[model samples]
Target: MAGRGGTQGKSGDEVVERGGERDAGGGGMEGWKRKGKRSPDSSLRHVFPTPSAFPLFLHMAGSEYGRTARDVLVACLALWSVTSLVVIAVWRTSPGVRSMERCKAELHRARGRLEEARAEWGRRREELQDLLRKSAQNQTHLRRQADQLTQSLRNSDASVSRCLQGRLTYSISRYLVF
Candidate 1:
């Protein structure tokens, strides 16, 4: 539901991590509770724990291999690092492309939302301008009528001056109203 990087969206159920230890809900030290070494009816007695692997490797290293534990570990790590690099290089072409594709899709979706917001703003601006123009037109008409009544009151003949004054007063009262 969120953006691509923040989506937490995976196309599959596999729990994958980029070299970081993840237990889905815990850590390796706490032991696997859902998969791999952990399963219903499984016991530690039947499982050769990963910690024993180091001792076994050390024994083999000091045996006919003529390697110290340090040398053997370095060799193993070097091999591990190199093999991991090779596998990453190969898989990068696929997963990397998929990740890029997802990013592009999210970008497109954001762009669409941005465009829709801009369009709505432009429409509202036009409507506001229209309303402002109508208000100005009404105000102009009122000002013109007020000026006409003032001019008529000053220039009227003295015979109908009272009538003109009364009519002007009536017109002024009308203009004073909204």
Candidate 2:
């Protein structure tokens, strides 16, 4: 049932996984197709993997001309199929060449998203640091202003004491003369 090892081909009549892929299932031709069917919502269909460029070769091979073609044409298809199989095998039993390309594209997109998130986080952190620095500077300025006001009040008190002493001496001297 399985080819080379205990693993079986996903193309077996068992429909692989019905409509959707099990989380632990390995990659298979049928698994890829069924994964798309799991969703009922049309909008969600966009979430499923699209047929990659790899399918185009298979589609062309299965065309009407493919069947009625001459011996040379059949030979060509056989060669194409063999090459396709080799590419898929070397790539570690993936669906097909096109599918792998799609996977690569998706990975690139995910990398881009990660980079964007990193940039956003860095920007926010910098903003927070700046705000904290400004708050500290403002607090220091207020403390300096308070110290200056307290010193000015002390000076004003000393001046009032001297003025009162002068008035008292003048009044006492005038009473003695009377």
TM-score of 2: 0.35
- Give the TM-score (vs. native) of candidate 1: 0.31
lDDT by residue for model 2 over 131-169, one digit each (tens)?
999999999999999999888888887888888888888
Show how many residue pairs clash in every candidate, following the order shown: 0, 1
Across residues 41-77, which tens digit of lDDT does each residue of candidate 1 receive? 1243244456766434433432334246557788999
Candidate 2, superposed: residue stretches over 4 Å from native:
1-111, 172-177
At residue 101, candidate 1 shows an lDDT of 88
Estimate the lDDT of model 2: 0.59
